[model samples]
Target: MKLRKKVDKVLGTALAIIMGVMVINVLWQVFTRFAMDTPSSFTDELARYLMIWVGVLGAAYISGKRLHVAIDLLPSRLNKKGQTKLKVVINWIIIVFCLAALVIGGLRLVYITFTLKQSSPALQIPLAVVYAIIPISGILMIYYKLSDIINKQL
Candidate 1:
C-alpha cells in the first residue's frame, strides 16, 4: 500500500506536468491561430503526443489506485467468500489477458515506430518516443495488478 501510494504520487505529479504542458501547447496554438497571423504547425502535433502520454500515465495512476471499473451485479449479491473468490478470478483474468495484450501490442508499436523511423509531420519528433509510453504503461499496470493480488488474495 505504501509503495502503491508512492507510485501514485509520482505518476500524479508527472500527469500534472504533462497535462500542464499539453494545455500550454493548446493555448499557444489557439492564441497563435486566432490572435496572431501565423499559427504554429508543430503545436497541435506536440499537444496530441503529450495527450497520449497523459492518458497512458493516467491509466497507471488509476491502476495503482484500484479505481478501474468492475461490474458489481454478481459480486454485490454474493457471499463474502464467494465474492472474494470471484474477485480473485476476475482480477487474474484481467492481469493475464488485458495486461499481457498491452505488453505485446505496446512493444510491437514501439518496434514499428523505431523501424520506420517515424516522426511527427509538424514537430519532427520521433514517434517511437511517444509510442514507448505503451509498454511503460503496461509494465506499470502489471505491477499494480500484482500488488492488488497480493493485498487482496494472497
Candidate 2:
C-alpha cells in the first residue's frame, strides 16, 4: 500500500505537469495563430501527443483511486461481504481486460510502430514513444488492482 501510494503520487505529479504543459501549448497555439498571424507548426502536434499521455495516465490514476465509472445498482443493495465479493469480481474482470486489450495490444502496437519507424509529421517524434503510454498505464492499473485486493484482504 505504501509503495502503491508512492507510485501514484509520482504518476499524478507527472500527469499534472503534462496537463499543464498541454494547456499552455494550446494557449500558445491560439495566441500565435490569431494575434501573431503565424500559427505554430509544432504546438498542435505536441499538444495532441501530450493529450494522449494525459488521457492514458489520467485513466490509470483514476483506476488506482477506484474512481472509474461503474453501475452500482447491485453493490448498493449488497451486504458487506457480498459487496466485497462483487468488488473482487469486478477487479478481476478489469485485470483480465487490461491484460488482454491494453497490455498485449498496446505492446504489439508499440512494436509495429517502432519497427516501421513511424514518426509524427510536425514533431517528427517516434510514434512508438507516444503509444507506449498504453502498456504503461495498463501495467499501472494491474498493479493498483492487485494492491486493492491485497489491501482489502488485510
Candidate 3:
C-alpha cells in the first residue's frame, strides 16, 4: 500500500509541476507578446505539449481516486444490493473499455511513431516522446482500476 501511496504522491507532484509549467508558459508568452512586442514560437508549442501531459497525468490521478465522471443518478434509487451490483458492473465496464482502448491505440501509436520517427515542429522533440504519456497514464490507470476492482468490487 505504501508503494501505491508513493506512486500517487509522485503522480500528484508531477501533475502540479505540469500545471505550473503550463501556467508559466502561458504567462510568459502573454508577457512577451504584449509588453515586449515579440512572441516565442516554441513557448506556445511547449505549453500545448505540457497541457497534453497534464491531461493524461490528471486522468491517471483521477482514475486512482475513482473520480472520473459516472452516471450515478439511477444508483441512488436502487436497493443496497442492487446498487452494489450496478456499481460493480459499471466499474468493470469502465476498466475493460479503458484498458482495452489503451492497449490497442497505444500500441498503434507507438508503432507509428517508431516507424515515422515523428518529432514536434517547433520544439524538435520526438512526437513519440510526448505521446508516451498516454500509454504510461493508461498503465497507471489500469493498475489503480485493478486494485480497486480486487479490493472493493470483488
Candidate 4:
C-alpha cells in the first residue's frame, strides 16, 4: 500500500509537470507561429509526445483510484455479496487483459521499434522510448488491481 501510494504520488506529480509543459509549449508555438512568422516544429512534436505520456500515466493513476470506466448495470441489480463477487471477477478480467494486451503487446512494439532503431521525425528521439509507457502503465495497473484485491480482503 505504501509503495502504491508512492507510485501514485510520483506519477501524478510527473503528469502535472507534463501537462504544464504541454500548455507552455502550445502557447509558445502559437506565439512563434503568428507573431514571429516561424512555427516551432520542436514544440509541436514535444507537446504531442508529452501528451502521450500524460495520457498513459494518468490512466494508470486513475486505475489505482478505481476511477476508470465500468459498466454498473449488472452490479446494480445484484445483492451485496453478489456484487462483491462480480467485482472480484471483473478485476480478474481486467488483470488478464492488461497482462496479455497491454504488457505483452506493448513490449513487442517496444522491441520492434528499438530493434529497428526507429526515431520520431521531428524530435529524432527513439520511438521505443515513447512506446515504453504502454507496458509500464499496464504493469502499474496490474499492481493497483492486486492491491485493491488485497485491501478488500484485509
The lDDT for every candidate, in the order shown, is: 0.83, 0.93, 0.83, 0.90
Q: Indicate the worst ten consecutive residues by lDDT in candidate 3.
A: 145-154
User: 55 in model 4: Cα distance from truth in Å?
Assistant: 1.3
Residue 72 deviation, candidate 4, in Å? 0.9
Between candidates 1 and 4, the lDDT winner? 4
**Number of the top candidate by lDDT?**
2
Ordering by TM-score:
2, 4, 1, 3
What is the TM-score of each predicted model, taking all chains together? 0.92, 0.96, 0.90, 0.95
Q: Write the per-residue lDDT of candidate 1 for residues 65-98, one digit (tens) a residue.
A: 7787767899889999988888778768867765
Q: Write the per-residue lDDT of candidate 2 for residues 1-154, one digit (tens) a residue.
A: 7798799899999998998899899999999999999999999899989989999999999999878899989999999989999999999999999998899999999999999999999999899999999999999999999899988941
Q: What TM-score does model 4 achieve against the real structure?
A: 0.95
Pull out the clashing pairs in model 3.
none
lDDT at 82, model 2:
92
Once fitted onto the true fold, the runs of candidate 1 whose alpha carbons sit more than 4 angstroms away are none
Clashes of 2: 0
In candidate 3, stretches whose alpha carbon ends up further than 4 angstroms from where it belongs are: none
lDDT of 3 by residue, 1-154 (tens): 6767998999999999889888989999999999999988899899988988998889889888777787779998999988878877876786777677775687679779968998889999888888888778878887887777677742
lDDT per residue for candidate 4 within 28-140, as digits (tens), equals 99999999999988998898898899998999999998887887999999999998898888888989999998899999999999999999999999999999999999999
Estimate the TM-score for candidate 3: 0.90
lDDT of 2 at 136: 96
